[model samples]
Target: MKKLRDGPMDGDMNGNQRTHNFRFLLALAILTPLVVSMTVMGLATFHFGRLSVGELTGTIVQQTVARVGAQLKQLQDVAQDQNRLNLKVMADRPPRAGDFKRVAAALAPSFEVNDELDGVYYGVEATGEFFALLRGTNQVVNLLERTLDPDGQWSRRISRWSGTDWQFLEQLPADRYDPRTRPFYQAAKTARATIWTSTYEFWPHRPGDRRTTGVTCATPVYDGAGQLQGVWGVDLGTIELCDYLAAIDPEVPGYPFIVGEEGDGTRRVIAHPNRNMVIDARTGMLFRDANGIRDETVKAFLRQIPGRFAAHAVHTASHTVPLRLSEFAPDSVAARTRTFEFADHGTNYLGGCFVTGRDDRLLIGMVLDKKEVMRHVNRNAAWFAATFAAVLVASLIGVFGFARRASRPLVELQREAHAVGRLELAPSDPPLSHIREIRELGNAMALMKTNLRSFRKYVPADLVGDLVRSGQEAMLGGERINATIYFSDIAGFTPVAEQLRPEEIVEHLGAYLQAMSDGIAQHSGTVDKYIGDAVMAFWNAPRPNPAHAADACRAALANQRQLDRLNEQWRAAGKPVFRTRIGLHTGPVVVGNIGSEHRMNYTVIGDTVNLASRLENLNKLYGTRILISETTRAEAGSAISARPVDRANIKGKTTVVTVYELLCEAEAETPEQAELRRQTEEAFAFYQRGDYARAAAAYREILQRWPADGVAAALLRRCEELAAKAPPPLSQDG
Candidate 1:
C-alpha cells in the first residue's frame, strides 16, 4: 500500500495522484490560450461586423429619408408651379365681376388635368368674393361661391356637379370664415409670390362634415398695371401625401413623417404612419397645439429643433443610449442630412433627418430599429461564435480524453449549475469527486441552488421566470406597455386600525389582502405591491393578456365579492368588517423591476397609474365602492355594468377623463339595479351637458326609489347647489 498526499502532490507522491495532477494542469494550460485566442478573434470579428452593418444600414436609411424629402419638395414645387401658372393666366387681364365665371371655368380644367390638385380657388380682394371648385369625391365635384353683401357681409352658395350640369345645392348660413385671413393668402400677399401654407384641417361645405387635413398653395394675382387684385390658390389634400408616406417599403422597418412650422412657431405633424399618433386619442382631434402632443417621438423631434433650423447636430451611438429626448438637442453642426441613433425600451433605433421643402422649415425623418436593420449582421456574428466554440470544444476533446474522464463528475455538477441558473432546480444527491477542489465546488453549487429555491418564494414566480429566460440577474429598465392597473384600498382603514389592537389589525389586514390577492391572481393579474392597507396590481405585463381590461374589471368585482365573504367571517368572529374601494384604468404604462442595485421591485409607473390611484381616492367623493376610467369601461365592453360618474379634469392631467362607477356584472344586475343605473346615467348625462335643473330632478327620482344610493344623493346635492347659484336669465328688454 502507498501513502497519498491529501492536499497536493509533494516531491514524493502516489502514482494515481501524480497522474491526476499532471492531466488537470495540462488541460487547463491547453484550454487557457485557446479560449484567449478565440475571445480576441471573436471580439475583432464583432467590432468589424458592427461597423460594416452600421455603415450600410445608415446609408440605406439616409437614402430612404432623402427620397421622402425629395418627394415632399416635389409636392411643394408642384403647388408653387400651379399657383404661379394660374396667377399668370388670370393676371394677363384682371377679371371683373362678370369675368369671374370665365376665370372659374379656366381653372376647372386644371382640376381635371392634375389629379394631385384637390381644389382650385381664386379670391377677389376688391369684391370680398370667392369662387372655388372642390372635389367632393372621386366622381363628384362641388362649386362654391362666397358673395359680399352691400352691408359688408358674406354668404356662401354651393352647387354640385351632376356630370351633365351644375345643380344648385343650397345657400349656407353667414359666418366669418374668410379666405383673406388665411395664412396662405397672407403669405402670398406679403411675399408677392407663390407660397405654401402649413397643413390645416379643411372642412367641407356641409355642417357636421368630417374635415380633411390639407395644404394650400397661393399666389397674389395682379392686373397688367401691377396693382394688387386678389390671391389665386390651389388646395392639395394630405390624403395623398399621407398615403405616399405610408407606402414606403415595409421591409425598410422605418416610418416617414412630415413636420411643418405652424403660424404660432410650433411644429405640427403633417403626416405620420399611424394617424392616431398625430391626433388626440381622447378627443379624436388632430393636434395643432405642439405642447399638447402625446407622441413622445414627435415631441422629441420638435423640442430638438425649435422654430426654424439653422445649424443642428445629430447624436449617434453604437450601444443603447438613454431616451430622455432632452439629450437630442446637440451643439451647432451644419448638415443637410444627418443620421442619429436612439434607444427606447431596450431596443436601439437608427434615424435620419432631412430638411424637406424649399423654406427648410419642413423636416422629413425616418426611424428604423437597429436590431431589425442589423439582423443579418447578428446572424453572421452568431455563426462565427458558434463555429469558434465548436472548434474549441473539438480540439479539447481530441487533446484531453483522459482529463475529460477525470472531470465526468464535474460535468454533471456543471449541468446542475446551469439548471439552477434557469430556475429549474431538481433535487439530486451531490456527486462524489476524488479531487477535493471539485467536490467543494459541487457543494458550493448545491448550496447556491438551495438558496435560490428559497429566494424564489420571496419573488414573483413570473418575474423570476422572465429573469431566468432573459439570462439577466435583474431587470433595471422599464418598458412602455398597454396595461390595465387595479388599485384597491380599505375605505376607512385608519379608523379601523386605531380601534383594533396592533396584532388584530395585522391579522385582519393580512387576511383581507390575501383574499384580494387571490381574486387578482384568479384573473391573471400581477399583484405588484401592497401599501399600508391597499393593494396595487396590473394585467398584461410579464405576459400578454388581450382581455386585460375586461379581466381587471372582473378581478375588481371579484375582489369586492370576496371581501364581502371575508367581512362576514370577520363579523361572525367579532372582528371589524372591511369595505374596499377599487379603481381601474387602462392605458400605456412603464413596467419593470426598478430600484437600487441591491434592492429592487417590479412595479409600474406613469400617468395611467397615477390616474388609477386618483380614481381610487375619488371613491370617497362619490361614496362609490368602485370607479374606473373611460378607457377601462370601453375596453371592459358589455361584460360589466357601469354608470357614468363624471368627466373630471384630474389634478395633475390637463385632459379630462370620464369616470364610471362599476356597479356589477351586466348579466348579474337585478331589475332595480338596472333601473338605478339607467336613472344615474340619465342624470349624469344632464349634469355633463349643463342641464343642472333636469339633472337635479333625475337624481331626486333615483333617491325616491333608492334613498340609500350615495352616488345619486351626492349628485342631487351638487345639482341643487349649482341650480341655486345659477345666474338669473336676462330680461327681454335688456
Candidate 2:
C-alpha cells in the first residue's frame, strides 16, 4: 500500500487494484489435470474402442454370411429331397397328357410337406406333357396342365384348389411356352442329375397380376434301360428370401444379396433386399448385372464384390487378400467363406462373401458401412468419456467449493455475454454471489438476455443482425426493391386434406412445407409466410441477390423435383401425393417491416405479388407445373429452359403478361423436351394467329404423341369450340 504509484502498473488503469492473474492461475492449476486426463482418456478410448468395434463388425458380417450360407444349403437339400420324392413316384415312366389328375394328386401333398415350395411340376420329354401345382400370395393353390394334342395344338388349362375341390380358373393358349425349351427342363436333361436353374420370372397366373421370381431344381427321370423318360422339378420363389434378408437386423442399415450360378451357367442376382432389383422390368427376367441397381450406396457396396468369389482381385492391390474364412465349418462341403475390407470415397467398409450350393455355386455377400459400425462404438465411448470427465469435475468441485462459488457469478456472466453475442438469448437464472458487484453484473446480463430473446422472436434473425451491426433501430417503413416473387399452392389440396386425419394432415403438410422452404432457402430466397398449402417467398429482400429471377426459377424447379421424389416415396408408402404449381414474377416491390407499432412482419407487397398469385391460379386452367411471367423469363434468360404458354390478362392488373411454362435448367434440357417445345410452339403459333382448324389438328397430333398431355387436351378443346363457331375456311386455291 505504501508503494502505490501515481500511474498505472503493468498496463492496469489503476495501481490500487490487484492483478487478476492470481485467479487465472488458480483456474489453470485446477483445470490442468482434468484437461490432460480427458484428452488422454478420449484418445485411448477411441483407439481401443475402434479396434474392438472393427473386430466386432467383422465377426457380425462373418456370422451373417455363415447364417445365409446355412439357409441356402438347407434350401438346396429340400429341393433335392423333393426331386427324389417326385422321381420315385414317377418310377421311370413318362406321364401321359391324361395323367395330369393323377400327377396333381401325387404333388398336392408336397405343398403340405414344405410351404417353401412355390411350385412342383413334372415335364414329359417324349409326349410334351406338363403338370404343375403352384401357390400364390393369396394363399390359393393353382394346378396348371399342358397337353400336346394329336393335331399338334397345345392345350392349356389353369385350375385353383377351393379347399373342397378343384375350380377351373381359366384356359390360355400354350403355344409360346414349351417345357422342353425352358431352362429348368434343358438343364436337368443335359446334366442327367439334380441341377438348380437360375432365377427367372414365374409365369403370371392371370393377366395384370404381378409376376414373381423363382428358381427351379430339376432332376432327370431315367428309365431302367438308361433312356430319358421325363424331368421332375420343384420351384423355390425368391420372394421369401428377399423378405428374410429384409428381416435380418432390421435396424442395421446394411443389406445382403445373393448371386448364384444360373441355368445359363452365368452368375446373376437371385435375391435382394429390394425385390424390384432382383427382376428385370423390361423382360420380366432375373437381373443379370449390377447396372440394374438403383441405389448409389448399394451399388458402391456391390462394386467391391468380384464377379467370382474365387478371384483374388476383389480389391485394389494394397487391400487385396486371399479369400479365406476359417471360422466357417471346416467339414462343410458346400460352404466356402471369404472376408475383405476396402475403402470407397474415404469410407472404410467390411464385407464377407460365402459360397454355398450343390457345387459351391451360389455366392452370398454382406457389406457393412463402417460409419454405421463406428457410430455405435463412438456413442458408447462418448458416454464413458462424459462420465469420466464428470467424475473429475465433481472431485475438483468438492475440493475447491468455496473458491468456485466465489468466482461462479463472473463465469456465468461471461457465458451469458458470449451466448448473447451468438444471438442465443434463452433466459437463464441469474448466478448468485455474495459480492454485490458480481451479483449486479449477473442481474444486468439476465435482463439483457430476456429483452434480446423477445426481440429475436419478433424479428428475422438476418434483419436483426444487419440492424445490430449498423447500430440502428428497426422502424416501420418500406423500400422499393427489384425482387423475384414466388407463389406456390398445392393442386387439389382440399381433397387431399379431406382424405387425411387432423394429425396426419399436420405431419404430411409439415413435410411438404419443409421441402418447399428448403428449395426456396437453398436458392437464396426468403420464405415470407405459408397460407395453408401455399408458400409465399421472394429473392433480393433482406439479402441482395443480383440474379433474383434465375434464383427464383431455380428454386421453383428444385421444389418440383423434390416434390417428385416425395411423391414417389408417398406412393410407395400408400400415402397421397402432393402435386404443386408455382408461379414466378420479377418486378419492383415494397419490402420492409410492416404492421402497427405493437406487431410487425418483414415481407414484400405490391402489384407484382398479386400478379404472381394470379399466375399460380392460372396453372389450373393451363395444366402446367410452373408458370413464369414474361418479365421473369426475360430476366432469367439462358438460366432456365422455358416455352411460351399464353398471354393472359392478370385478374387485378391492367397489363397482359405473356406467361411461359418453366421446364428445366437450360443445360439440363433433353432432346425429347426440345421436341415437345418445338411441337407445342408450332401449335401455339397457329392458335395465336387465329388458325383454329390447323391449331386443333396440331394439338391432336401432340396428344397422339403424349397421351397424357393435359395441356394439349385443354387447348385442343378450346380450339375445337372456336373452329365450330367460325365460318368455314376457303380453299387455298380460291
Candidate 3:
C-alpha cells in the first residue's frame, strides 16, 4: 500500500515516468475529475451553444429562403394577372377576319402582358375557327383571323397568299378547317380560357423564312357578352429564359437548370445559371456530372431545395463513465466540421462549421461558443477535481513543509503568468520552476506574450480594440458613408512630376502628403484616398460628426494654405514652385475597398466622387484656387465666409449646384473684399433676371475695384455677349 501510494514520486524512478511526482500526482488525481468533468461539461455547453446558434442560423436562412421564394411566387401571381388582363382586352372586341389585320396593327404596341418578355398573343375557342399569330421579339404577324366554316355563306380563304410575314409557321391558308392539329390551336381549344402551355417550338413564319420550336403562352379570347371567342398566345425561344437564370452567379461555373417532369419525359433545359451554359433541356437535359456535382448539388441547387442529413448522437463509453457525442448534417452548406481548443483560461469543446453562402450564411449553425457556458463547464469539472486532489494530498502529508514547498512553485508560476497579461514585466523572465515541466510551461507562456505585443505594433492597439468592440468595423468589408469628398491636384503637378527624378518625386509627394495629413486630421477629415498627384480627402469616419462637411471645407482651405507655405519655401530654395486646386463635395458614397482581396485601399466611390473631380477641373475655368459644392456650403452653414462663384449646371448633374469659393472665416473677410462680394451678388441677381446689360455693367464695376480678378473678367465677357442678345430686365412683380 505504501509503495502504491509513493509510486509516482519514487526518487529512483527513471525520468521518463518520473514526470509523475508524489505531490503532483495527488494534484493530477484531484485534477482528473476536474479535467474529465470539464471535458464533459464543455461538450454539453458546446452542444447547447451549437444547438442555439444552429437554430438561430437555420431560422435566418429559412426566413431568407422563404422570402425569396415568396417573391418568386409573387412573380407567378403577376403572370396570372397579366394573362387575365390580356383576356379582358381580347373579350372587349371580337375582330372579324378582315378586321384581324387592322386590329393586330393597332394592338401592336399593346404590352397588356409579359412586359419584360417578347410579345403576347390570343386564340379562339372554336377549333380552326378564329386563329391569329403575332411577332414575339419585335412585331405582330397575323397567323389566322378567320371564323373557319368551310361551306359557310362567305368563306374567306382569298387572303391566304397575301404574304404579310407570319414566317414562324408554314404559310397558312386564309381559312383553315382543321386548325386543331396545330399546337397553339389544339391547346387553345382545350383551355377555353387563359392558359400557359409547356415550352413550344413552333416558328411564326416571316418574310421568305421560318421560325422553329419556341416557348409559347396562350390565352383563350372572349367577347364582352362573356362568350369564349378565341385564344391569345405569345411564342418565344426557351433559350431566353435559360439565359436569364444563368446570370445569377456569373462567377460560378455551375450553371442553373429548370428541373421537373413534364409531358411524356420530354425534358428540356428550360433555364440555366448563365446564358453561356444553356443546353436544350428538351433533347439533352442530362449533361454535366463532372466533379461529383451532378445529381445532388446541381439539381438541388437549381431547385433551391433544402436537403436532409443523417442525424446521430453517440455517447462515448469509457471504463470510468459514458459521455455523449452528437452530430448531423442538416444541410450540405455546413460541409466540414472541425474540433479546436476554444480556450482562454481552460480547455473547451468546440465545433467549427465551415460553410459558404450569402453573408457567410452557408457556415451558419448554432453558436455554442459562449464564454459563460464554457466557464461554467470548465470550473465545475476541472476546478472541482483539482481542489479535491489538493485537499486529499493535504490530509496525507505528515507535516506542512513538503506540502508548502511542493505547492509554492505552482503558485509562483501562476503569479508570473498573471503579471505577463498586465504588461507589468517583459517576457524575458526565465521560468523559476525547479521542476522541468513547470519550467517549460512558464517559458512557453512568456514566449506567447512576447509575440502578442508584436501584433499590437503593426496595428495600433487602441484602434484594433475599438474595431473589435464596435463589431461594425469588423475589419472585413467596409461600408458606405455619407462623407464629404475632397480632391486636390497640384496645378503644375504634371510638369513638376515630369521634371523631378523618381526618388525626388517620392520625397516631394511624401512631404506634401504629411502636410495635408496634418491639416485633414486637424479638421476631423479622413484622407480617404490619394490619386497620385490628386489627394482625395473626406470627413466622417470610422466615426461620424454632423460637422463633416465643415471639416472637409476647412481641410480643403487648409490644404491650400499648406500648399502656399510649401511653395514659398520651395521658391526660396530655388526649387520649382507649384499651386494646388481643391474641390469639395458632400454626398453619400460606397466607402470601402477599391482593390483586389490581397491588396486594397479604403476609399469612397459614386457619382459624388466624379462630381468632385469635375468640380476640380472647373477650378481653372473659375480661376479660384478652392471650390465647395452647394451641399458642402449647406453643411458648413454660415460659419465660413464664401462667395457664390457660379450657378453652373455641372455636367452629369441635372440640378444646378451653386458653387462657392471659401474666402476666410465668417468674421475675417476685409471690408473691401466683402463689398466686392456684395457687388458680385448683385451681378448674379441681374444674371438671373435676364438683364445681361445690367449684369455685365455690374461685373465691370467689380473688375474696376479688383482688376487682377479673372472671374469678373470672364463673367464680363459672357454678360457682354448675352447683353447683345438680351431682353429688357424684369420688374419686381414680373
On lDDT, the candidate that comes out on top is 2
> What is the total number of backbone clashes in candidate 2?
1
lDDT of residue 399 for candidate 3 = 32
Error of model 3, residue 98, in angstroms: 82
Task: Give the clashing residue pairs of candidate 2, or none.
Answer: 198-263
Instruction: Highest TM-score: give the candidate number.
Output: 1
Tens digits of lDDT, candidate 2, 238-287: 77666656655624546678876644456667777887776667655566
Residue-level lDDT tens digits of model 3 in 235-264: 544454544443334221112234322334
Each model's lDDT comes to 0.76, 0.77, 0.57
Q: What is the clash tally of candidate 1?
A: 0
- TM-score per candidate, chains pooled: 0.46, 0.42, 0.40
Best first by TM-score, ranked: 1, 2, 3
